[model samples]
Target: MEHSHGAHRADDIEDARIKDLTERFRQTLSTKRMNELVSRSVSRASSPAPRDFGTPQPPPSVSDAQLPTYSSLRNIPLVPQAPQDARSLRFKNMLHSLSNMPIRWENPGLLDEALRVVPLEQIYNEAEEESQILQAEAESLGAGKKAAWGYQDCVVRALLRWFKRSFFTWVNNPACSRCYSPTIGVGMAAPLPDEQARGANQVELYKCSVEQCGAYERYPRYNDAFVLLQTRRGRCGEWANCFSMLCRAVGSRVRWVWNAEDHVWTEVYSVHRKRWVHVDACEEAWDKPRLYTEGWGKKLSYCIAFSADGAMDVTRRYVRNVSKHAVERNRAPEAVLLHIMDEIRAMRRSNMSKQDKFRLEGEDMRENRELRSCVISSIAHEVSKLSVEDIMNGRSSRSRADPDTQKALEGRTSGNSEWIRARGEGGRGQPNPQDPRNRQR
Candidate 1:
C-alpha cells in the first residue's frame, strides 16, 4: 500500500513538471514572435516616407517685394479709438444694406468694414497684454507656460489671442478693409461619452483622430451663437476653442465670433498692425498660404479665372450672410456676446501695464477655475460611461466597474508590493498602508 501511494505521488509530480515546461516553452516562442512582429513594424515605418495626406503642392516662388516683413510691434497703443462719426455712418449704411439683402453667408463687407474701423493699435496692445497674463498665470500654477489651459479662464483668454491674431488683419496697408472669418473653435471637456444622454439633449465630446498621442482633447458641442452647420463633431466652434487655448498657452489674446446661425469662427488682434485680422486655423491644408487666394490656384486649376479675387469674394460672401440680422437689431448693433468678449480684449490693451493685467488675471483665474471645474465635472458625470474621479486621476474604467478598474489600479501603483498586498487584504479598493509610491518621496 505504501509503495502504491508513493508511485501515485511521483506520477503527479512528473505530470506537473511536464505541464510547466510546456507553458514555459510556449511563452518563449510567443515572446520571440512578438519581437519579430515589432521589428517588422519598425522597419516598415522607417523604410519609406509616409504617404502624404493630399498631393503636395510646390512652394510658391516669392520675389523680393513679395517677401513678408516679419516686423515685431514695439509700441502698442493703450486705447484704440475709431472715429465715432465714421463708425456710425458705416454702421447705418451696413444696417440698411443688411435689411434689403437676403440671409446669406456673404455680407458684402459690412461687418468687415465696421470691425476694421476698430483701432488696430489698441486691439493689438490689449491682445498682447492678455496673452502675457495667461502665460504668467500658467507659470504660477506650476504648469508649464506652454502647457495647454483646459480650464475656462485660461481657455477663454487663449481663445481671445487666436481670434485677434487670425481674424483681424488689414486689407490695405492703411487698414481700410478687415476680415473676421474664424472657421472653427475647439472646446476641451472631459470624456463625455454617450451613455449619460438626457433623452435627446445630451452633448458628446469626441477625441482627435491623429495618432501621435497628443494631450489635447476637444468637445464638438453646438452653440446657437455661431452661424454654421451645427455638427455634433468637428465644427468651427470647437476649432476656435482649440486654437484659443493653444494660443493662450503660448501667450496671445484671442476670441471667437459665430454667425447668428451659430457657425463659429475666430479673430485675433495684431499688436504690430494694431488691428484685428481673420485667422482660419482649422483649414487642414498647412502648405497653403496664410492668406486666402494666394495658394489656391495650385489646388484648383479652374481657380485661375479670379483666383485671388475669387478667394476674397468667396470668403466675403460668407461674411455678408453672417450679418444678415444686424440690420434688424438696429444701428445699435449689439452682438452681446461679442461685446463682452470685446471688453475682455480691451482689458489687455497696450495702454494697460503688465501690472494691471496681472491684477485682472488674478481675478479672472479664480472665477475661471471655478467655472471650468464645474464644466469638466458636469460633463464627466452627465456623460455616464465614466466617473469624474476617473478622468481627473487619469484612471481607466471610470465609466464601468470592471476589468479596466483592475488595469488602472495596476498602472497607478505599479511596482508597489506593499500596495498590492494591502489591496488584497482589505477590499481591493483600499490604499496600501506602506506604499512609498504614494509618499511625496
Candidate 2:
C-alpha cells in the first residue's frame, strides 16, 4: 500500500511538469510568430517591390467606376445673379447702405470711450461667479461633463443684464419738458445742424397731449453709437446700435441684425459655443431667435445680420416655419439677394489677410450648417407633436402648439399696448396700416 501511494504522487508530479512545459512552448511559439510578423512589416516598409518586366501585369481594377461621380452627387455651386429689375436694384442698394452700419462703429478711440460707461469690475465679478457656478454644476453631473457656457459667454450675459437694466432706456415718445406731459406723434422733423453733425440722420417731432400747455419736442434718431452713449434712449435701432458697439468695446465680435419688419437687434458671436447668439438689447433677450415671430406674434420677411467681418441672411433662424411665420420675400430675387450678400461679404473681407478670410469662410460654413439644423429641428419637433389621428384627418397643429411657444405668444412686452398694437406686434393680428412698422427711419 505504501509503494502504490508513492507511485501515485510521482505520477501527479510528472503530470504538473508536462502541463507547465506545454504552456511555455505555447508562449514561445506566440512570441516567435509575432517577431516574424514585425520583421516582415519592417522589411516591406523599407524596401520597394521588384517589378517583373518580363511578365505582363494584370489590368488595373475599375471597382469605383460603377459609383456615381463626385460632381453628380454634390450640389452645384451657386453663381450669384446680378439685379436686373428696379425693385431688385433698390433692394441691393438699400442692403449696401445698411451694410455700413457696423463699419461706423470700428473706431478704436470711440470704442475705448464706450468702455468707460460700463461697470467693468461689477461685470467681471458677475461673470466669474456665474462661470464658477456653471463649472461646479458640471462637476456635480459627473466626469467628462462640460459647463453650459464659458467665461466670455458669462461676461456677455452679465453685460447684457447691466445694459438692459441699468444702462439703456427704451423710448416710444418723448415726454414734454415744460409740463412733463405725455406727447403725441406729429410726424418726422429735420435734424438740426448739430444733430446732423453728431450722426442724427432723422428726427421725430412730438407735441404735448395737454390742450393748454402745448409744447413741441424733437427726438433726433442718432445712428452714431458714440453719440448714443450720452443720449442713451431711442427705439429698436438705437438700442441695437449702442448695445452692439458696447459688445464690441468689450472685445466681442458683434453683428447688427436688421429685420425688414422695422425691428433690429444684435448678434454676438460666442467663441465658446462656436455660433452667433441672438441678443435683443430692447428685450434683453439672449439666443432667442424666435422672439419676434413666436413671442411678439409678428411675421418676418427678412432678417439680415451684418458684421464688420461679413454679412449673412439669417432669416431661417427667426422664421423656422416658412408657411406660418414668413411673409413674402419679394424685395429681390433669391439669386439677386445671394449676389448682394456676396458683394457685401467681399467688400468687408477685401482688406483681410488670407488666413483671416479663410477663418471667416469656415465660420460662414459652420453658421450655414447651424441654420440648416434649425430648420430640420423645427420640422422634427413639429412631426413629433403630430398624432396618428391628426395625420389621418390632415389637421393642423394649432391646438397642439408647443407649450413654450404658446407661452411666448403673450404679446410684445417692450412698448405700450397702443404702440405695440400700432406696430402690429400686439399679437397674431392684422397690422394697423396707420402705424406702419416699416415706415422710413
Candidate 3:
C-alpha cells in the first residue's frame, strides 16, 4: 500500500512538470492565437479529438524550393511503423550475401598490382583532351564557373573508354584453347592447382564443340583483381572489380556497387563534385546512374554500394522512375536496413576523429537530401511529360518510351558510338532510326 502511494505521487510530479512545460509553451504564442488554443484545449478536454488523415498541402504563396523549409514538424513520422511486409525477408537475405563481393577489393597490394596493366599514357592523354574541351566550354559560359567534369572525372572516363574498348572482353562462352572453335558447357570442376593459387575458388569446365578434337578446357572464375589482369575478360562482376581497383590505383576512392538483379558497377568519389560519381567499366559509362532503369528498362530493388570504408543502399541514385523501375523492396523492413547501415558506419568510423566524423555526417545528410531531391525531380519530369489526355482521363494514352531512353535525356543518342564498326546498330552511317532526319532520308 505504501509503494503504490509512492508511485502515484511520482506520476503526479511528472504530470505537474508536463503541465509547466505546456503552460510555458502557451505563454510564447501570440495573444490572439493563445486565446484560440485555450478554447480548443477546453473543447478537447471535454471531447475526444478527431483523427487527421492527409497532411496540409502547402499554401499557394510558398514556392517549390521553399517547401522543405516550410514543412511542419507534424509532417515527420514519429511512430516506428513497419515499412514493408514479411515478404521482403528473402530480399534482405540476398543483400547480406551480396555484401561479400565488395569486401574482396580491400587489399591494397592487389589493387597496386592491378595498376601495372592499365595503359596509363593512353588514358592520361585522352583525359587531358576531354578536360581541355570541358574547360573551354566552362570559360565560354562565364568566369569562376567550374567545368562539368573535373580532371579526375575525365581520367576515370578515359580509363573507362580504354578499359571497355581496348582491354576487357565480354565472355559469353569459352572458346577452344586447342582448335580455336566454340566450346560447349561440360559442367563445374574442382579448381586446379594453378587456378586455386590464382584465387579461383570455382572453375567451369568446357569441351570443344568440334567433334574432331574433344579437348576439355578449364575456365576459372578468378575473384582476385590481380588475377583478372592476366585473364582480362568476364561478366559484370569482373568488370566492376578490376576497374574499381584501377580507379583506386589512380588515387580515387572507389566503391563496388552490387545490384539485386545480378548486375554490378562502380562509384568513384569525386573530390571536386563533393559526391560519388557512377562509373560502369563494362559499358564504358561514367556518371549515368539512370542507365539501367531508363536506358535498359531494368527494374531494380536494391543498389548497394560497398567500399573499404562503409556500405550504402544507393538504390535511389539509379531507380528514379519508382513506378516503373522499382521492384519489390520487401527483403527486410526499412528499419533493419537503417540499423545495418548505422552498424557498418559505426564500425568503419569508430577510430576517426570527431571533426572527421562531423564532416562525414554532414556529407551523409547532404547525400540523403540529394537522393530525396532526385525523386522529386523524376516526378516533376514525369508530370511534365504526361499528355493532356492522360491528365484528363487519369490514364496513359501514348506508347511506352524507348528502352534506350538516355539518348534523348543524356544526348548520348547512339550506343554504336563505341569505337567499333560492328555489324549492327549505333553505326556511323545510319542516323538513329527514331530521328526524323533518318525517316525522311
Candidate 4:
C-alpha cells in the first residue's frame, strides 16, 4: 500500500511540472508574437511607402512656426525658485497674504455655529430629490453609466440656490435705513466700535441719494465669515466668503478663489469626481469656470484658488483661449509664481501626516494633468476649425464671429448695469474707463 501511494504522488508531481512548463511555453510564445508585431509596426512606420510610379518623394518640410502652439498655465513648472527682483517679491508677499483667506474659515467651532442658521432639512430634501433624479437619469441611459453629479454636489447646488434666492442680498449701495432711499457712494470711512467688534476692518460711507435726507449711512465690510452669517448682505466678496464657509459647515472642502480683476468666487472639492468644482455664489454658478471670460466678456489675468490645504493658479480652467480671454500675467515671473505656490502648499501641509501628504501630492499631480488637458482640448477645437484648403495654402482660417454675444449681452446677472459696465463685465461693449483691470490693485 505504501509503494502504491508513492507511485501516485510521483505521477501527480510529474503532472504538475508538465502543467507549469506548458504555461511558461505559452507565455514565451505570446511575448514573442507581441515583439514580432511591434517590430513590424516600427519597420512599416520607418520605411518609405511602396513606390506607386518610380521613386518615393520625401515628405514636404513644415516650418516649426506653422505648428500650432497651445499656450496654457501648465507651462509654469512647480520647481521652486526664489524671487530675484523686488517686484516679484512684492507679488509673492501679496499672494501669501491672500492665501490666508481660506485658513480663516478653518475654525471648526465657527463652521458649526454657521450651520445653525442654514435650513438643513429643506436643503437636504432638495439635494436628495435632485440626486435621485440624476441617478434615475443615468440608469435610464444604460448600464455602466454614472450620474451627472453626486449627492454632495446636489447638496451644494441646493445651498447655492437657497443662498442666492432667499438668504443673501446683493447690495450695490445700501439703502437708507430711516427713509429707505438709495445711497450714493461718499467714499471710505472708519469702522465703528460695534463694527470692529464683529471683525469689520473697513467701512464704506454713503449718503442718502435724496438731497433732503442727506444722512450718511455706514456699510461695514466684515472680513469674518461668521459675521457675514448675521449680516448676509454685500457684493461678491461677502457672498463668496459666507457661502464657502457654509459649504464647509456641510462637510465639503472649500476654496476661496480670488481673481485679480476684483472678483471672488468659491471652489468646492468634489470627492465623487476627485476634482475641484468652480462655484460662483454671487451668480449662483456651479462648475462654470468660463462664466467670467466667455459669459461676461472679461479678460482674466489671474484666478488663484486658495484652500486650507494649498493654493493653485487655476487660470487655464477659466481662460481656455489664451489669445482671446487671457491678459498679461505680469504680476511675477513664472518661476517665482511656482515657488510661491510650493511654499504655501508646504506651509499648509506642514502639520499633516505622511499618508495625507502623499494623498495631496497625488491630487496635485492629477490636477496638473487636468489643466494640461484643458490646453490640449482647446487646441484640438481650434484645429478642427481649420479647413484642408486653409492649411495647404498656408493661410489661417477666418476667425469665427462671437456667437455667444447675445448671451453675453445679458451682462452680469448679479450686479446692476452701472456696476457691471464700470467693471468692464458688460458683455460686448466698449471698454469702460473705470474698469478695475486698468487700475493697479
lDDT of 2: 0.81
Superposed Cα deviation of residue 4, candidate 3 (Å): 60
Candidate 4 collision pairs: none
Q: Give the Cα lDDT of each candidate.
A: 0.35, 0.81, 0.70, 0.81
Candidate 3 lDDT tens digits, 180-230: 998877687898898899878777788999999999988777777887888
Q: What are the per-residue Cα lDDT tens digits for candidate 1 across 315-389?
A: 221211122201133333233222323333453344777887676455445534543553465445445666688
User: For model 3, what is the C-alpha lDDT against the true structure?
Assistant: 0.70
Q: How much is 379 displaced in model 1, in angstroms? A: 48
Write model 4 residue lDDT over 340-430, tens digit each, in one string: 9999999999999999999999999999899989888877777877998999999987666444322333457887888877777776333
Q: Say which prediction, candidate 1 or candidate 4, comes out ahead on TM-score.
A: 4
The TM-score of candidate 4 is 0.79
Worst 10 residues of 1 by lDDT: 303-312
Name the top TM-score candidate.
Answer: 2
Ranking by lDDT: 2, 4, 3, 1
Which of candidates 3 and 4 reaches a greater TM-score?
4
Q: What is the overall TM-score of model 1 with all chains considered together?
A: 0.22
Q: Against the true structure, what is each candidate's TM-score? A: 0.22, 0.79, 0.70, 0.79
